[model samples]
Target: MTLSLFSQFSSPSLLGIPLIIAALTLPWLLLSLPSGRWLNSRMTTLHEWFIARFTNQLFLPLSIKGHKWAPLFASLMLFLFSLNMLGLLPYTFTPTTQLSLNLAIAIPLWLATVLIGLRNQPTHTFGHFLPEGTPTLLIPVLIIIENISLIIRPIALGVRLTANLTAGHLLIHLVSSAVFTLLPSMTSIAVLTAILLFLLTLLEVAVAMIQAYVFVLLLSLYLQENC
Candidate 1:
């Protein structure tokens, strides 16, 4: 774990690890600039159509109109979702399965949740932190607890993705190793181990999709609560 942490951060520039962060973030920046209007324009539709003809279809299949934020948000979600799913493929890495990458994606989401909440409900911003009805005596304790829990959201998100991906990979690797050790000179055993690895890879792909959906669902919930 410690070595992995060091390796992820050793590349201090935006070209590597930071590039992963940038890939997750650049869409947000593009989305933020247009007051959600530009994304819904005809030009944007044509652009998306053209891109779809060339790249994989990762955009939302449903219509997203008038809501300026939907297209951009959808694009970001698809990109992250696709990237997360890619790691399930053989000989490929899932950048978001790393602690640093998950944290990088989640912290901004947490911040956006807070800011959007505040922007939409200024007077009720702090109030949103606490449930509307609570005993007067319990308000302080509840406030503190809620605040801490809110802070833990991103941390938990990071740890969850990292642990799931790392554990699944290790499990598959260990199983393969065991199969090899048991039948070092047998092609049959080698073929059997390869098949098991392939099956496990499929399972991991499903898990990766689940993890990404979990992250996105949590984020959408946060936004919905705040808005």
Candidate 2:
């Protein structure tokens, strides 16, 4: 029983090759493909609407230069949203739930944004380390603090995704285990717990979607700053 709850997250492998590669690729397979005709299918239309809305919302705050990031950011949003929702299904493991994977995604993107800032506007980017406020004594301390914050962005991004998904999944596992255990002994209580589980699952669904959005949203914000 304990193993059932814990083992859901264990990375699955076959013949020394991790199956997470399959999990990551599966979501893209389910997405609607573009057509060459004037008319589009309902799935294709809905997909276009969602992509348009998300692109507008994400890039609205960025400078003109940031417009170039639309494709990358939009693709990331769809990719993450799919992965998060798919993990909720039975017998499926969430790749994003793995901190290593999240960090792998976060670090390079974060570094690229920073590099863009430095390359395009060297003086302005370095100026961010110390604000314009006139505090002669606090300059060194503030510089250190801001620099630390800069370096920690990727780590925070990875940890936040990992922690939220991990917590929600663990809670779902616990409540589900309770529902099953109580069914044989306390039927009435089991029914109540089942109802609660249903609601929690719905909330988990929303969390999964929101967390994926927030992950990408923060990335865009970082890009906006650099742009």
Candidate number with greatest TM-score? 2
The C-alpha stretches of model 1 lying farther than 4 A from their native spots are 1-67, 185-195
Per-residue alpha-carbon lDDT of candidate 1 for residues 1-227, written as tens digits (9 for 90 to 100): 55743343232344344455554554344432224663566655755664464223332332232133454445555566677665555555567656887798889987887787778777777875678879899999998998898899889978987888777877776777767776768878778888888899888878876776677656666666666
- Whole-model Cα lDDT of every candidate shown, in order: 0.66, 0.92
Residue pairs clashing in model 1 are: 36-68
Candidate 1 CA-lDDT value: 0.66
> lDDT per residue, candidate 2, 142-221, as tens digits?
99999999999999999999999988999998999899999999999999999999999999899988998998999998
TM value for model 1: 0.65
